[model samples]
Structures are given as C-alpha cells and as structure tokens.
Target: MSRARRTLSATVTLALACTTLTGCFDESSPHDAVRDFLVGWQSEDYDLAAGRTDGERAAVRKALANAKLELDAASFRFKIKSVSIDGDESRADFSAEVDLGENNPLWVFDSVLPLHLVDGRWKVRWSPSVLHPQLKEGQRFAVDTKPTRRQPVVDRNGASLQRPQFLYVAGVIPSQLGDKDEEVVRRLSAITGFAQDRLLSRIRSSPPSKFVELATFGRTRYLAMKPKLDTISEITTQRQEQLFAPDAPMEIVGKVSALTPETEQKLGGPQRAGDSVGQSGLQQAYQDYLTGSTRTRVITLDLRTGKESALLQEWPGRENLSVKTTIDRAIQAAAESAVDQAEVSALVAVDRSNGEIRAVAAKGLDEEDDGLAGKYPAGTTFSIVASDALIKAGVKPTQRLACPAERTVGGARFAEAGQVGGPSPTFQENFAKGCVTALASLARRVDAAALAKSAKAFGIGQSWQLPLQSFSGSLPKLDSDADKAKAISGQTVQVSPLSMALVAAAVASGTWRPPVLVTEPSSPDPTAEIVPEPPPQPVALDPKVRTALTAMMRAGAVGTPAQTGSGRVYGVAAPAGDEGSRQAWFVGWQGDVAIAVLARNHDPAAVAGDFFATLHDPS
Candidate 1:
C-alpha cells in the first residue's frame, strides 16, 4: 500500500483513549533516575543526568557555561508530570511554553521525549541543537537535549554519495508563551497538525534544559510538507557539505532503513535505531561497506542557573572507514540507460579475465522489486541445454537432423517454428534455425539425467553473487518423467535473463565461473573471499564436442548483418522464437570479449536489429 494512504488517526486514537482515563500520567515520573534526568535537564546539567560518566559531566558543564556558543538564548520552560521506564529505556511526559518577549505563547504536549540510562542515570536522547545568534541569548534557553547521528552512504567507486553534515530547524519564540499557551498550541498544531492537547502537553512537560526536538522526514507526507515550510512559523532545512566518487548504477545504494513494516516494528522503530539498513540497490547488498560508525559529543551546563557552566566539550563517536569496489561507472550508466525503456529485463556484465563485475541492472523492475530472485519460465532459449545434450549423445554439427512439425510426449505435443519443418537439415543448420522439434528429437536420444547435469554445469539455477543486489534465478530438479521431458524442452524450469547470460558466458570461456559483482583481489586466496572462480585451466568440454558447438554458434550468426558487425563477430549464435519470439538473443565471442544481448517485446527481426545496434554502439 502507498504510504500516503495510511491513516495515523488510528494510532493517535489508541494513544489518547489510553491516556485519558489515566489523568495525564504521561506527565508523571516513574523512577528516581527518570526524575534525576528531568532535574538535570531542567538545570541544564547534562553531567548530573549522565551520572558524571568520567568527563562527560565536565564537558557538558563546560558547554553550559558557554551557552552563547553552544545553545539558543531564548528560554522555553517545560512541565513534566510523569515518566515510564522499561529496562534501560524511558520516556518523559511534558508540555512546553516558549517566550521570546513578543507574539503569543507557544505551548505543546503529546510530544514523546526519549530518554536513556547513562552510567546509571537517565538522560535526554536524540535531541536537536538550535543554531547560532538565536543561541546568542545567554541564559535565555531553558531546555537541554542532545543531537542524533545520521548514517553515511557511498558508491561502488568509494565515492561519498551521501552524508550527514548539519541542518537548521528554526522558529521565533512566542511571548504570552505562558498565558496564551493554548493559542500558541493551535498555531503549532497548524504547522505540525498534531492534536492540540498533545502539542500543549509536550511544551508544558519538556525538560527545562531541552531546546528543540530533532525531527526527520518520517513518511512521504512529511517530505511533501517540506515545500510549505515558509508558511509555517517553524522552518527547517537539511544541507550536504561534501563530495565523493561517481556512482556505479542508476540509483543510490545506502538506504539501509528501507525495511518492511513487520521488520521495523520488530526492531523497536526509532527507539533503538538499528544501523542504517540496505533499503535498495547496492546499498542493500554491500550495506556493510556503506555503514560507518556513530559518535557522541558531551557538553557541560550549569545546574541551577540553566546556562552553560563551561566553555569546552568532548564527544564519543567512531571514525569513518573507506571501501573499494570494481564497477565501471561509464559502463554502468550505459547499461542502465539502455534498459530503462524496457518493462521487465535485467542486465549483468562481468570482466572475463578476472571475476570483477562491471555492471548489473534490471529493466521494468522498479527500484524496490525483490522478486527478481524468483523464477520465470525461459522460452526456446532453453534449447541450448538440449543441443548440448544432443552433442553429448554422439551427434555431430555436420550430421543431418530432421525438423518435424510436432513431437508428442506424455500426451502433450510440442511444435517447432522452423523455416522448413517437413525435411531434415544438418545439426548446425537446425541449431542456427532454432529447429526446436529437431533439437528435442535429438535430445531424446541422450539420458535426461545427463542433460540436467549439463545444464547445472552450465550454471543454470545457480545462485549469482553480485556485490550489489541480485536475483538468484532457479531451475527445479527433475524429479519425474514429466519433469525430465519438460526440462529438455525448457518448459518445466524458470530462469532469469541474468542466469541465461552467465550460461552464455560460461560456454564462451570454455568452462563455468560463477558471475560476480564485487572486485577481485590480486593474487587472492582462492578459498577465502566468496566469489566465482576463473574457468579451469583446461576446457571442461571434450575437444570434439566443444568444436561442434562452436561451429554451430558461428553458423547461427551467419547471413545476418545485424548479428555480424559487433566486436568483429568472430563467433555468433541467434536463438529465435523464444517467449513468443518476444525475446531475441545474440550470443558470441570476439577473442577475449564475449557478449550476450537479450531483447524483449519485439519480433525476431526487430530484436535482432536492436541487439546488434547495442553491440556496435556500446558507448
């Protein structure tokens, strides 16, 4: 369901119904630690709230003394009535009243303030710091709160794609901020649309040391409301201040929080923020690389005067680390742009010499599509498995084979879409022509088990380990006579275009090497890093069988100009009538470079036309 369609009214209703009968217990304190936290905050004493953890107390005291340099000057008083403690976690109920000496008072409740235990004492958590000049008002700011950390994201090229620097959330303080608190509540309500009592309650009960609550875009609606910041008395802006490497794919990768509702709920929502999660693309895949460390900074504030008691501060946080990858930015962009026009297609390219991946993409699948890993039936292109089976069964490429109209098996008839179905043609001719019936007839002579084995050896149904996101296309096992028959005809199993390309790549390389998307190490340990190995030193296929298949692929690309011009076109093969001829493929090799192009939603002729166009103009 779309996020906009969700109604937060239900959640608000539940919270209100429970709190109404309790007489605002939301303003009550549940423990001494909670009380201490509030008292320290009210006094702007972070050290006391922090339980004087080593020097955090001293740092906070120092920051408090230099209030003009550290906090906003205007004071906003908060009244707290109660608190709830769950293990090391806690929440304080409060209402706030802001006074700037002008305008009406600003009041709010219903604001949930998060608190945590530090060195055995409860303290305010995830707070937003006010900006300068406003902070110029020494001894005016009353509330105390700390800042939250934002996660960073990077591209495959180790470029700094996304990072958190600093932002400003602002508004003018209202006077009568205490008497006209209700009217002020209504204005804040207009900006936030939160319930009046809730807004009022938040302002009334906030810790005296707290200034402002740190806010983020919670949902699509919140993001949409961003444009109207000018209309609202309070306005905020997020800005970036750094640059990094160019991106590999079309989209950004480090969206780690991209989780489902069930998962998010299990993780305690924003209360116990799990590290930023891979929400989509490479970010979702190599989340570890993009994930860095979080830091904490502590300052000192006065205990009774509610001012900065010191002038220095220290914080505890982690340093950043860099990661390197093996994607070609230019190639990734080219592939992404080419496939963007398709409804449902995927493209993956790997370096042949080393197993480093250059690019990976999906056409038609939206950025959030995870179903790509599942199965989809492969059409006639599956015949490659049958052809390999035929050659293994002693059939020669030059040997004549008959192309028939139909072949019945298990009471089902399979038809061929060849040019001349009445007569016979050479094995090479049949393959070039995609004489499905003939290939099936020849495949019948081979053991079904052996054919399935060959398919497996060719990486069919094998899980591809791309560094970013990927689909582990599959092929179910042949368990029965019906399944075995369907397998030979490419009907019983489903496969992804990525898997098909790997199959072509394996044949071109003379052996199987699982396709990879991450970078390959120099003189790397063959057993440590989890990646596909290079094709074996010697070819897996017998010399004779390999020769026959090579000749057939070459013949398949003959007499077609579109299939002939890309990369010298030394080796070519066209598989026609696959998926209602909606997908036309050209697989070939030019010395060390091997490429495969699969086209969707086009006639064989049109598919072939576009296939060569991309090959010749892969710029």
Candidate 2:
C-alpha cells in the first residue's frame, strides 16, 4: 500500500540525432533541456531543475518539499510522458506517482511542464500548473482521516460479553471551589488516597463549570469512605455505570484504558488524548482487527485561509468486523462461581470434540493465570501419563499394588496414601485413593524413557497454539531412581491446569489437539491478509492405553474425596505437594467436556463435584 510503480506506457525516451560535447542531446535542442529538467525535478534536486527553468529557485524547492510532507509519502516517482517543440518554445508532459502510506491506491496523475527559449537555450517556464493542473498559487495538499466505528470482541455465538457495572465518581465543579480549591483538594486527597497537588492541578485546568473528576472507587469501597469524603465542603459524588467485561478471573476478556504518550504508539496513526485501546489479554492481542482502519481523504487546503478547498481522493475503511473468540460466557461464570470459596484456584474447561477452549477461570491470588500458566507439581495426576508408560510396558491396570501409609521405591520415600482400599486393592483402586506410595512403586515396571515418551503422546510439553503465557506439562529427566519415584508420584514434576485439561481431553476424545482461543482476523490491506493459523496437530492416544486409563480412573475414584461426583463422572483427585498446607486437584472429563481444577486451601474433589453438579442445573 505504501509503494508505487511507473506505468510502462507513460515512459518516454528521446534518442535525439544531435549531440554536444556533453555526449547527450545537444544543449541547444529543446529536447535536451526538457530531459535535463525532468531528471532534476524527478530527483527532487530543485536547484538543478530551477536552473533549467525560468522560475524562482526558492519557490520551486519549497513547493516540491511541501508535497512530500503533505502526503506523508513513503515513496514518489516520476516518468517523462512526452515532449514536443514549436519554434523556440517547447512543452514537456510527465507522469507523477506519490505513495501515501496506509491509504489504498497511489496519488497518480499527469501534468504539463511548460518550456520557453531564453536567448539560444531552451528553459522551462514553470508555473503553479507545473505542480498540478488544479493547484492554485497559495494552495497546499492535506490529508483527513476519519476513523471507522470500532467493533466489539464477541464469543462464537456473537453474544456481547460486556455488562454494565456502576462505580462512584468523586469530583468537584471548578467554579464552586474558588479560594477554597486547594483546601478542598487536600481534604479530598486524604480521604481518597489521591495526590493533593494532582487533584488541585486538574481542577485548575478544567472549565470553571465543569466537574473535574479526581477519583473513582467501587460501590462498597465508596460507601465505606463516604463518611470521610463528606467532611470536605467542595467535594461531590456521583454514581455512574460503565460497560465492563464479564467478571471472570482468566483475563481472556481483557481490559481497556485511555490513550497516553506511552500507549499512543500502539495505534497505527496519530492518536487522540482519550482513545480507547486494549491493554491486556485477547483484547490487546487483536487490537488492530477490533479497532479497524480509518477512512482517508487527500484534499487541498487554501494556504491563505488554512481551510479545505477541494477534494482529491477518498478511501473508506473496512468496518463492523467482529473479533471472534471461543469463550462461552455462561460456562465461564459458572466455573468461576464454582471455585469462589478458594483463596486461590484455577479451573479450565475444553470442548472434547475440538481443542476450542470453553473457560479459563481463576480467582484470588492466582494472578499469573494459574489455570493457564502456574506450574505446580501435579501429584497423583501424573499417574495418567505414568500409567500409560507402564501399560505400554505390559503392566496390567488390575494388577494388585500395595497401598500403605508409607512406602519407598527406588531409594525415594513416599507417603500420603491416607488409607488402604478394600481388602485387596488393585493398581486402579490405589490410584483412586490418591495413593502416592503404590503409584511410585510402579516406576519399576517400565524404564524412565517410556514416561517421557508417554507424556509426549498425551500432548504434555507439546507446542500450545494459544497466544498467552501458558505451560504444557514437563517431566524431569529420570537420570536416577529417585527422580523416577518423584516423577511417578507426581511430585518434582510441574504442570499447569491447562496441561491437565488437554490430558483429560485426550482421554475423552482419544486424540490430543492443541487448544485454540481466537480465530483469524480480517485485515485492512486486502493483499496483506494474515495467514490462517495451521490446524492443531492431533496426537492419537493408544487404544489399549486409553481404555486402561479410563477404566482405572473411574474405578479408582471410588476411594477418594472426588468419588462424590454423581457416579456419572470419570476423573481422579490427586494430592499436590505443600510443606504446611496442600492444594487440591481434580483432572478428568465427564460427558463431552473435559475439566481440570486446582484450588488452594480447599478440597479438590469437593470443588470438582460442585462444578459438575452446577453444570447439570446451571440455575
């Protein structure tokens, strides 16, 4: 869009028969002077062009330089179209193309270069017409940008995710402050925790009758501080509602703030003082598509009047293009509500059929999007992958394994199996009971390499297609028996809640596909259309391993806290590592949706049960 090309038909080459000592057409020939004038003008060497012209040198230079700045040109090229001679005068026609970037199509046209004879030498008799056919003596080129309507980010169903939320806005009308303005501002700052000088400055610069907002607070917080705020005579308060994104912890919905010097560069063109722009999450990632392009008009301004005089060309921007996402708003709210009691928690749900994400809910101290990226030892959850590794090595799911309060394997001690399962618990029985000892012992049935390979097959540590800070599961090198034991017990192994969700998805769908959050965006430049992302690569699970793992988890859930999930759910609860207090976790799937939950200071099994039960009712 910022480049230009010379039209081949407009190119004119004159091979004059006459030659001077300069080895070109003779200087006296009108064609020679026209050729020299064209070269100098095209190169923007106004001095040389004026030398071959009868125009004022400074005026010619200023006009040529002004055109480049007015167009904000990236590149401008000129080509000689034709030349003719009549007596001592001549006429030279040329094509000019100026590239105005970010605006579709180049500014291209043809204008005449008037020539005359001065003594025996041919010279161009330049005038305002030489620059443009319609340009007047005191006219200049100007560009007008009209921004198109910004589009909202919507879910797959095109449902608006934004809802109205009210806040308390505290301010004062500058005219009412008068001599007490500084005193009033100081008192307001003390109550509101805002800078006194900053508040005073805002009030002074604002219109005398206008309300100068100094601070804002949530409803509850404002109510608590209202008593103190009332002490200031000039203080005022107003409740106003603004559109806010859905109240979910994942931040996938994003937030917006006004344009600032720091953020102005984020937009493509000159920014206004208060332009809205995305600051984080999907909103920031897809800002260009959401904001769209601006309509551009190339016009002329009467230099003397400093006002628009004529229209040259106009191009409209693509508008009303929505940025689509895979988030299910209802599901997200439900997920967040289910884990509301935890001090810190993360829960992610995915569609079992495809990798499209359904929800990414986290709360409290899980600021790092723990659901998407907080890496923690997965506890007994890694058993899914470890089980697959052993199963491939020919270990039976029903093989009886000892579940004791404490056990040791490969020189590493393991505990935390609170109680034994039944009279004779099998490997599956121990697994459901959150048996760290029994599972760690199984590390002997297969080599360490099988664990890594099985982990890969489950999409753990694979490439995640999301444009976010996320972690795929990672297994430590099993260089020693102690490493294998810890890895097998799910301690010393770190994985995110998202990693567990995909693992559950693999079990449910039998093929693990990378997760997707956003779709392709429409671009302003037609030829600059963005390349569509490659479809997620699917890692097919082994039929034997999948069948064994599914059965093992369903039967195993019978002896653990997660055993409460309405009998219809198939998942497993695992104990995460903590020195003083342990976190809770449930990683598995039910029906067509796979889920993973990790909660601090709460029961993982109970959280999972509550989540599924709520999904069933959703009331």
Candidate 3:
C-alpha cells in the first residue's frame, strides 16, 4: 500500500477491532486493570502501563503513588476477599485492615470500588466525573450521593420558614428490581406528586440502582396524594436507615433511622410543603438565622438480610438557629391593614422610654426599595432640627422674625412650602405653620456648621447600627451661608421613612436605639430581661420653643387640621381656617409610647367630615 493508504488502513483496522470487542470491553470493571497497571509501575515497567489510554494510565500511576506512600509510612493493606462480576460490572468487596506501624489504623481507610469492563477489560467510573481522579490506588474514598443545602428562611416570629420538602430516595441491590418496586414507586409518586409515568421511567431507566428524585416545596401536596397512590400495588419497602433530623413543624423530635418510605416521605414535607420558606416579608431578611445545621449518616447494608448496621462516618451540617424579632404579630397585621389603604404611607410605633421599635409598616412599598431604606426630602418635619439649631443660637420663638416668601443665601433664592407671595410671619407663627419662608430667614442667622451638627445629633446622616440593615439618612452640611440656606429649606438632605421614625424615636425616648428585626437579639436573648441603650446627650432647647413645637404638632393633629376639616381623634375640633392638608400626621407620646400616623392623599375637609360623622353615629 502507498503511505497514505497504509495510514488509512491502519486507522480502519483499529476502528474495526474496537467495534468488534465493544461488548467484551467493560468500562466498569477496571479494578484489575488498575491493579495490574499500578503493579507494573511499581515494578518500573513504565512503558507497559503507558500503553493504556492517558486517563486510565494516569489513574493507575496516581493510585500507585498513593499506595506506595501508605505502604512505606504505615502498615495498611486492602485485604481483597473476592472479586465477582455480575451483569456487566465488577464489584470488589474487600476489607481494609491496618497494622498501624507508626500511626493509627483510623488514619487509613477500607473501601469497595465498583468498576466497569471496557475494551475487554475493566475501568473505574465515578458517577460525578469530578470524583474519578480523586481515587488513589488502594486509597479508600466514598462517593458523594446526596443533595447539598439550599438557602433557608424563617419568619420574624422565629418560625422555620423554608426546608427540604422533597428527596431523591431509592433502595438498591445487586439483582432484579427490589420486590414491590413498582408499588413502592407508585405510592411514593402519589405522595410526592411525581407523575406515575416519570417514576416508572426512572425505575426502568436505571435497571438495578435506586432512583433519586430531588424533592421541592411541593411535598405537602404530594404527601396528601400518597395514600391514594399507595393503593395501586405492592412496592419495594427497604429498611432505610436515614440518620438526620426530619423537617418538623413547631416541634422538636428525636433522631430516628430505618424508617419506612411513607414515614420518610412525610418527614420530608415542610409545614405546608413549599410554604415554610419566606415567600415575602421578614422571612427573606433573616434567612441565615432560620436555616439550621444538618447531619448525615449513610449506613452500609448487609445485602442478604436487608440489614443496615455499619456506621458510616457522620458529616455535620450547620445548625439552623432560631431568630426572634421585635415585631408584634397582632400589631403588625393591624398596621399593615390600616396603611395599606393609601397609595403610600408608613407608621412607626416605639416605646418612648427606651426607643424599642414596636412596629413599622410600609404599605405597598419595599422596606429595601422605596420604603425605609430609600431617601426622600423630609418636608416640614425637618423643621425640628432647624428650630433646635436656631434656638441654641439664642433665637427664641417669641422673637419677632421677618418671614418672607423667599430668602437668598449665596445669591440663590429659596421658596417656602406654602407662601402667599407675601412677607412671612414671626418666628413662632412660621414654626407653627411649618412655613418655609420663616425657617429660611432663620437659616440666615445661624452658621451652617452648627445647624448640621444639631441635625446629626438628632439622627440625621447616621444609622443606629441595627443588626438588621438600615439606611443612614443623609444630612446637608451647612458650613457656609449657601449650605445653611439649603439646610433650612430641607433641600440638601436625603431622608428615609425609617430614618424619620428613628429621629422621632430619639426625640420621644431622649435616646436612639437601633432597629432590630431578628426575634432574638444577638445579645440579651428575648427570653431574658430587656435592657435599653444609654441616654443621649441632651440638646439644648428653650422650654418655651419645645412646648410651642409640641403644642403646634398637637394642633396640626387634632386641632389645626381638625378645624380645616381634619377631625379630632376625641371629637374636639380646633379654631377653623387651617389651609393645606399635606399628609395629616399625629406624632406624639401617650404615656411611654410614641406613635405616628401618616395618611396619604389627605384632605382635611374630608377627614374632618368623616371624623364628625363617626362621632355623631357613635360607631
């Protein structure tokens, strides 16, 4: 033949030979080939071993290197009892005995490897390809067979929210399908909501091996369907010795093994199968604390008697700890309902004595998105900081102040929230009415730095360092005339609803406490006595101005807004003629509690009408 024809002929001959011996070649029975290859290498017959494929030869060489180390460093021997071939695979069940020459036998391992026959010989194959190369000649190793962990969740009430609801369960032996395999699968499929056809397909697809189907949240529905399906036929019932904590609902149970498929199937279900995890709300926030630890033990079976006694080593999973939150379920529900009526509204209730957050509700808004975590202009509420700064600067509310519609600082003119395009009122009147003009004029008197400092001390541009994430509302630095002007205008700073609540909380409690969502405080678990943060440094306020502000806020709540048609909570109406109805709010302390109510699309007239109507009807 010519050179090209000769090359082609040789390739064709090699292909033909491979095709002819395909059945004789068992890829799964390569243990002897592995052993022979390793021996050849140990005897320095590198060329003979190198004749095998690269992957197979590498596996042998690596095994030999490991075996050599073990033999030299310790007295470890894999006593092979017998090697048998059933079907197309080879299983070498061997005992690993160690002499522990200078070490403990525990450091050595005994393992059985199932190899496949390929190309008239056997080759080892790992189900997951990654584990194949890890096998060292004569080195004992176990295969990874189960599902890994997924993200866990829980409610603010410390309830376990998410868990494994399904399983890839199967029982295997070295013969025909286990007895009642069909019946067992049908029942399992019924309980697990697995399609009968799919279950049968999986069982038939893997001839002798057990079938594993990963379970999901739909377990409850499947479980409910189990009994109906179990009536179909007798299914294989293997004595499964699973040593792990079953997903229990609101109860702690002891560890059990060798449970029935029905028991295990039910054990795998969540509280409401797929309902345990946090689909929305606080469950999503504290996922880590809710997911507990896991421990797995796989027992070796006594094939003949169907007994599982060998104690395989246990691998521990992280324990999912319970986290208690500060949320009150009842109050949360009420607040959610009340505020959910508006397009946008937030309510925050806190203990006035120590700043413990009682409840916070953001209707139709995300706490992490456009809710407490986001920033918005503080509106007239920022007047608290401005008034404080101005008071500390020796400007009293009684001081007659020129209130103008517009004020210029650094040549930039700013307008008030509600101005009739006329000169503004006195300091007291401006602060009472939440006028932008009067406050802007006050901005000209106080230096920017002092105002900014006062705002920070009042919980602006800072977080309370809550374990749960919170937004640090930004404050405008007023170092110069321009800065002071913007600060007074409420234009430079960005505030969030949560930040606003914190500010109100600080004023209410005379201190700032970080907001907490986890039911259990990392420190001083809730089961114990409650402790409060230290008191805050006092902000100097003229008692008169403070009283005036408090009175004015009250007036806006049940008085000013009430007269303008925003009715009072107790039926007492103030002197009429109050104009705008911008989000009527009632923020004040009753005993040791500080409560704030924000209403959207507020119309004082309609509010007052409804209030009076309710009182008249005594409903």
Candidate achieving the largest lDDT: 2
Report how far residue 610 has shifted in candidate 3, in Å.
11
Tell me the lDDT of model 2 at 410.
66
Cα error, residue 332 of model 2, in Å, equals 0.5
Give per-model TM-scores: 0.58, 0.72, 0.55
Model 1: lDDT to the true structure: 0.47
In angstroms, how far off is 217's CA in candidate 1?
A: 5.3
In candidate 3, what are the lDDT values of residues 53-161, reduced to their tens digit?
2355555455444333322222223334556777667665545442211111222344565666567666544321112223322223221123233333233455433
Evaluated with TM-score, which candidate comes out highest? 2
Compose the digit string of candidate 2's lDDT tens values, residues 224-278. Answer: 9889988886878877665444445337767755443345433433233223466
Q: Which residue ranges in model 3 land beyond 4 Å of their true spot?
A: 1-213, 219-281, 417-426, 466-469, 519-552, 555-591, 595-600, 603-619
**TM-score of the candidate numbered 3?**
0.55
- How many residue pairs clash (N, CA or C atoms closer than 3 angstroms) in each of the candidate models, in the order given? 70, 1, 50
- 1 versus 3: better lDDT goes to: 1
**Candidate 2: regions farther than 4 A off:** 1-87, 90-111, 118-126, 134-140, 163-250, 266-275, 300-311, 318-320, 365-369, 422-424, 520-536, 556-567, 578-581
